[model samples]
Target: MFISFEGIDGSGKSTQARLLAEMLRLQGHDVVLTREPGGSPGAEEIRRLVLEGDPDRWSAETEILLFTAARRDHMERTVLPALAAGKIVITDRFADSTRMYQGLSRGDLRGIVDQLHGLMIGREPDLTFVIDMDPAKGLARAKGRNGHEERFEDFGEGLQSRMREGFLALAREFSGRCRVVDGDRAPEVVAEEIAEIARKSLAWTQKA
Candidate 1:
């Protein structure tokens, strides 16, 4: 099974992804935990270019191209191989992120994103957890990280707010695979919920 965790920055999706991987590993599952824009060597290089520097370093159109290229490299080098080996692949972020960030955040370019996705990266996670959080609080947590990859956070609270809404809408759009999880609770609480859902999904997939 391919699983992904997505949310506004600092919405705890990253932590949740890690927790899920660890929990599954403890249960004797073979799992591969990865993240987009940097999952493979080529994609890692692209990650630095797109994630660092100023918020205006790349326009939405340019970012779409860069992200797509990275995703293609990731799929070819990291994701596809592991899946073929029968390992469950879990990623912190995936194409859903691009659909929200580069597609809708800057402007109304979701159509272009979808077109590029269908042509270049025609895959989606079997299960996606969109951790929902208040934009203002998320921004504060993201900024508190003080990491070099602050380009997106630098976009300010307004962008985060829009992203929260965009992600929720995206969950609705892809209702079959997307699961919206509330992110305001304790980490353990959130992790438990995700683990239970993932456990059920994994069982169902195995039966199928």
Candidate 2:
């Protein structure tokens, strides 16, 4: 099974993703927990370029291509091999990030993003957990972190709010594979809910 966690930065999706991976591991599942735009080595190098520097370091178009390249490398080197080994792959972010950041955030480049994804990286997670939360709270949580990856977080609350809406719209558009989990509650409570969903998804997949 391949799963992804999505939402505005600091929605605690990353934490939830780790928790879920650990839970699955403890349950004796062969699980791979990873993140993008940096899973494989080649992708990690690209990640530094895209996640740091000035907001205008690269034009929106250039950034999209870079992300696509990284994703392709990740799929070829890391994700595919693990899936072939029958491991449960849980990623912190995926192509959906580009759809929101480059396609929806910057402008109406969603067509380009989708076309690129279809052409180069044509796979979606079996399940995507969107940790929905208030933009203000999410931004506050993001601001508490210090990292070179602050580029997207630096986009500030307005962009994050729009991003939240975009993700929700996407969840609706791909309702079969996306689930929205309210993230304002305690982490333990949120994790429990996600675990339940994960259990059901695992069972369903096994039956199929």
Candidate 3:
């Protein structure tokens, strides 16, 4: 199973991803936990350049392309092989972040992102869990984690709102494969809800 967890920064994606992987492992299932833009060495380098550098160094198109570059590498080097080996892959963030960040946040680059996504991930996630949260709440948690904010995370209210809307749009567009979970709840509660959803989805897939 290839499952992805997505949401705005500080939406508890990483925490829930780890928890889901752990639960799957405890069930004697082989599982791999990873994240986008930094899953592989090459992708990690791209991540640093994209997230840590001066904002002006890259245009919206450049950002979309770089993100796609990293994603291509990550898919080739990590995601595909694991799935072929029968290991469940749980990713903290995936192509949706690129669409939301560079496409929606930056505007005018969604076509570029969509083309890259089709080229890279020919098949979308078997199941995508979108952890939805308020922008202010999510950003506050994100800032607390780093004691500072990265360039993308520093977009404040306007951009954050757009990003959240973008996520919802993607979820609606792929409703059959995407499930939005209320992330405003406690972390443990969210994890439990996600696990149940994953369990049910896995069963449904097998029967199909």
Q: Count clashing residue pairs per candidate.
A: 0, 0, 0
- Candidate 3 contains a number of clashing pairs equal to 0
Query: What TM-score fits each model?
Result: 0.99, 0.98, 0.95
Model 2: clashing residue pairs?
Answer: none
Evaluated with TM-score, which candidate comes out highest? 1
Q: Put down candidate 2 lDDT per residue, 101-167, tens digits, no spaces.
A: 9998988999999999999999999999999999999999988887778888887899999999999
| Shift of residue 129 alpha carbon in model 2, Å | 0.3
Q: Which pairs clash in model 3?
A: none
> Which window of ten consecutive residues has the lowest lDDT sum in model 3?
147-156
Where is model 3 more than 4 Å wrong at Cα? 147-149
Q: What is the TM-score of candidate 3?
A: 0.95
In the range 34-53, model 1's lDDT, one tens digit per residue, is 99878999999999999999
Best lDDT among the predictions, by candidate number: 1
By the TM-score metric, which is better: model 1 or model 2?
A: 1
| lDDT head-to-head 1 vs 3, winner | 1
Model 2 alpha-carbon miss at residue 9, Å: 0.7
